[model samples]
Target: MTQPPPPPPNQPPGPPPGDPQGGFGAPQDPPPGGFGAPTPPPQQPYGYPQQQPGQPQYGYPQQQPPTQPQYGYPQQPPTQPQYGYPQQQPPGQPPYGYPTQPQYAQTPPPSGGKKLSAQAQIIIAAVVAVALIVGGGIWYASSGGGEEKNDTAGATSGASQGKGGGNGVGGNGKEKAPANPQAKLAFQLPQPKVQDITDVSGSWLTDKAYVKTGVDSIVGYDLDKGAAAWTLALPGQVCGASRHVTADNKTAVLFEATKRVGPRFYQPCTEVGVIDLTAGKLVWSKSVTGGSAGDTKARFSEVTLSGTTVAAGGTDGGAAFDVANGNPRWSPKPNAQDCYDMGYGGGAGLVAARKCGPYDSQYVVIQNLNPLTGAPVSQFKMPPGVKYASIVSTKPLVVAADVGDTAGDGSGISDFFSIDEKTGKLKAKITADADRYAARCRSTEVESCTKVLVGNGRIYVPTEEHEGSSGEYGDETNEIVSFDLATGKPMTGKADAGDKYTLVPLRMDGGNLIAYKIPPYDKGGQVVSIDGGTMQATTLMENPSDDSVRDAENSFGTDYAEILYGNGRMFISDTMLSKPRASSSTKEYLALAFTTH
Candidate 1:
């Protein structure tokens, strides 16, 4: 009954001897002098029971039921490395197998005893091997094995938390979207009453953005801080919303009101609402009629702004409002039977209107009206058969063409001219090969056409290529021909081109043309910095895949893709509203911004 030495601190007491369960602790390594193969079992002492049939016959002891069955030791094999057991044994080690041997104590061979036969030695050796296996399993289960499994369980729980917590990389990687480095969540959109084909409609100023949530509400989000700056909710249901942002990004007009009519009819909202974006308040909401109700032709109803003048016209004619005070500057007689296209002539310091009497007719009246007084600065009749015309530039020049004319359309070949801003008289006419002049610009009088860029005293137009020619992909054309803005003659010098990439001039950025290179379908696109003074082109940054932009469009119901430049920053987003089916898991909207300065 002498006591054994106690274990070191933090170690559990070993199981009692003859306690049925084997002792629990680190298993002793094999003696340095390896145990020679077993010789034979020692003879039983007098009165010891004879070995029973079908029972263990080797010198091994009888099997003992596990003291703690809850440990489940020996019930299942440990597949992973446990305790100090190597994950995989070195070559020639005993292969892991069933615990065939029984536990037994080591006793020195009986001195001078008869050496056992070969068969007896084999049985004895096998028993010793099984004993080691069973002994190792029992020790692992009792001491810290339960805790190890628990640690594993805890790790699993942690992984689940990371997936659902809405933190960084919140969901399954393959199924989740990567965060956009260029933009952040400015704000969550309010619960939409109706999830229409359109997503959140928005427009951007320098540091702020105007987003139309639902039908009647406009929320201004601060782009720099990624938070809402202000929100204005108009009375009555609103639809067919369109936005016009000021050059300064401080003011905007949301032409979203009046229940929509048929596609061609526009019922202008009772009043147009002009928002002072920086102030986050409505600058003025005044009575107006003939605003668009989703009519493509009735776009005349949409609000238009130029310089400091903000104007909205409809079948009810047109009116100008002071952007500074929102006071009425001038308006035509109400219910006039004409459609007028209003826009800012930034270069001329004026606002002009082109009124078509019968809609898309061959000829229309053009007037360079004083934005402040609403009086004509000059008036002239468009050249006969001029099906499409826009006041693209205000430096006393007029450019007109069908944009794209093929032999079959019978829309006469595209022609351009320069006219006097003061006299509204034709000044000069110049021509380029219709097939080679690939400025297939949009016919809308409001939106700027990519094929024609007016800036830096030169008009940059797309030159064409014959079908199957190398430049057939005009978008991939690097060199663009420029024309003198004043003389209607081709300007000298070839516009610098990108390598195997066509450069399209979007707008004038300082003395450089802020433009983008049209990437091949699905490849991706990039913004280009064109030095207009030298026609030198330098790419700015590669844009995200067209798919990402398309995803934004699908979620937002945007009608067109656009790149907006302001405050030394580039804001690229979808414009207009048209619902396109999208994946349900897509983010609600996407706005990408890049530093341009």
Candidate 2:
């Protein structure tokens, strides 16, 4: 390198005599402005750092700062945005600039040099990666979206298998299923007869839930052929509950008026008129007593055949009824009783009633009956903190979780109890919960039951974790916790049905539980079948046709739609605006899922 001329021996050399051009890095005394002194004007931005006095200068070219592009680089968006922000646009007709696309020039061959070798290439690659990472972090800090936005949704996938020791029969026969399947849903829902329902609350006799014939009735589509069926109409509008057939398919009972909402409700007392579904004739009309306008009285809501006598519940909490021969059989009184959120076991001699009070206090009353005579033989009773209980036939069993302490946490204390059938006294108590206990049914409710279902080696209760619990913690996930029907312990590895819904009562067939899922009107939905024994799940039907929420007026209770399994054919109710003759007619349909073999 050639040397520049030195400063003469007269004055101090400017910039210590060896500074780069326009350099300001010089040793000097502190200014009067202590720390916040004005920074010296930017020196040669395109120049290298100046050398201090006595330091040798090397023959290096001054590197000019790269010009910022008219457009900049696009940074990757974040995995999840903390705050929603509008994307930036470039200078244009729009107010904000979209992010600029950054550009990098291809490395041109060095003057008179060949391409770099492999080792040199590796070093450059590492440096480039580090720079990109640092740049991405800076961009994320300023712009909010991080670099992981490239992949969204399903960040993790896993498999779940049936665990625990004994895999007893679920509502399905015992069988294990594939986990995390990589297949499509079996099939698509069929677009059936578009029945814009106004009210839909009729049970599925079998696996099918549809109605046929009448304007807004089962008229347009015939369930038998999967098409339109016959329509039957007399005169004024009829309601879904106006008349219903029995599970035996013997008679249809119509709910007469109590007040007029298009159809005048038979009030104070309404008549239970029975019309033979086979003959379609009004066989008999029996009117129960109703309260006078000035009284806060109760009356029958519906009637169910207990044995030969009709067992019924009142609008206000009571069960009483007249037999076929015009005799008052069993009467309902408030306990107030509860069904442990179980089946609407009322109607016959199985009415479970509850009288509830504050501080989790309750008096449960279940009417045990002469299943042969439809008369109450004895009333079963229970006190509060009785976690769960159920009845089979006239014999009732109560399940109370003895797990709570002063701190409200439980030791997972569980026990099963049998109450005397005739006296409602404790008969036998068995322990159910233990470390990793499989027999303890953690449910607060019990659903379907059968004679054989009760006698089987195990009985399954749909259990959920003690929610909002104060004691020992348990998984709050929904599970089918089975207990040995004989000994009462955990029995099987449960399965999740892939959906959550209100715990509704299920109709039972042997060990099989029959239930249906309905569409909420606005969207498509399905009906599912769960095998309690095999632990298998199947979608029997997806009726894109029925919409529950569309007809809000007629839908209130969990029994909004019914699923009953009996001698073969299923009779479903498809109803819409079953009233106000001259105007709009909402409709429903009944379909037979399969022919009776």
Candidate 3:
């Protein structure tokens, strides 16, 4: 395999040779006057065509400066295109490196669909290998350390409620925003050196501590000081974690039975367990094996929590265990039609994506399941040509899929189907253009989508970042829009990100939408609360504009980053970590926290 040359120093690695150049990168040095500082309007914005001087500028106002620089000022010319703005590709090309066909995981194609030739399969495998290498290289070259903090010595504290009034669990949308929300750097966790790319995707916030998954252990840090309060060592690395946490701060995870050895680089993810976030201990660990294939041990790809049930699903089949005592609830059994549960969605409810029928014409059946019983309450069969379906929300019953391989962007979504879980009937079909909407779902991981959210009977998603009205270099922005779940019609208002700032939907705060604004090179990021009805925005927390802080925040791009905001504090963490480049000097952090108090 031919390796691409390393990117220029401080610059993020670009896409492979035939791939398009895009995605967020490290922050660059701010020009004179600093970001968000007052500046005179330019004669014309870059990229866009020039207009007459008298006409009002399309983006930020040139005459009156913003009250506190809510949105950043125009950035200086970039030696290269900064993050968020992707260069356009020539016509008649794949959007990204992914092939046009819809990829399935551990499953065969539908009866009517064409199968990939042996040669094509090899080509796809090579593409995947190159992608993994490039991905690891990006982290190696782009990672840098942030403001240091003492994290080794501190007394453990009991889980407490967040400052204002809410618990730090699920952002239940009841936490009050501070009146004057000015955030400062709270603490940072230094990245641990690793010999290979490692997965560390889980993080949770509790009133008393912020718990995160480390390489081979889970650590709880004091909320204010960022010191390691307690650590629970594990026998193997965490393979999957549930984003949902119980009311009492209990979550679930899937892991391997043993550590990866020399020739055994890949280990089976067969262990299932529940973690007590408040107590910082693994409550119980176990593994099961069953199903038509009669495998010795079940390897799960995803795990989720619903009420007291810890449900896990994978290629072999599905299993559920009691979250409290790890008692067996149910396991896959031989069925008449050769059906098996591929994955499950849990949080407000428990739903399963079941694949059945013969190999050539296999179709997916979405079932709203009884969490404790593992029985289908109601089921809806997906249309033909739909290879896979992801559950976006279980309560309202929203499923996303790329019908007939038309999404083309590898986002794993082209349309959203709203169904009535009680009746198992389709209510509406929402057509979300892949190029227009920024939401995405992992092709195989049913519950692994981000950037799109469902709440208050509506679906919220951000528009793809486009050229800002400023017409200046690196002035790109986006906004949040919505669609009614019942009718699938466009909603009335929108939350604008302003110029040079990209807005991403984080979660819902009561009737307001909480979002993070990715600023230009010179400015710091901001967390804002947008009114659900009026679409107006309120600044919740603004970060420091210092270079080191900005770099730390920018290191975790919103696309693949895990962001948790609650109790007047925000945490940005990476889902994966890689060995730093031997020649690099910049420090790297596993996670960074900011607080408004």
Candidate with the greatest TM-score versus the true structure? 3
* Top of the candidates by lDDT: 3
**Tens digit per residue, CA lDDT, model 2, 473-552:** 33222333334433233333343333322122133333443333333334333333355555445544333333442243
For each candidate, the alpha-carbon lDDT, in order, equals: 0.40, 0.29, 0.64
TM-score of each: 0.54, 0.41, 0.71
Stretches off by above 4 angstroms in model 3 are 1-173, 292-295
261-286: candidate 1 lDDT, tens digit per residue? 44533443446556665666677766
The lDDT ranking, best first, is 3, 1, 2
Candidate 3: how large is its RMSD?
19.9
Using lDDT as the measure, name the better of candidate 1 and candidate 2. Answer: 1
Pick out the ten consecutive residues of candidate 3 with the lowest summed lDDT.
Answer: 148-157
TM-score of 1: 0.54
1-597, model 3: which lDDT tens digit per residue?
111121243332222121111111000000111111112223222221111011111111111111121111111111222111111111232221111111111112225556656666445444543443344345335533210000001000011112222112122245566977879999999998776778888888777898888988899999888999999999998999887777777788999898877543568888999998889989999999877548788889999877788889888788888888998777766555566788888776777887776789777777766676564555566655678888887777889887677778888888777777664556656666666677888878777777776765777778778777878989988777766667564554567899999988776554456788998998889988766655668788888889999998998878777887777888888888876899999888899999987
Model 3 Cα shift for residue 523 (angstroms): 1.0
Error of 3 at 546 (Å): 0.8
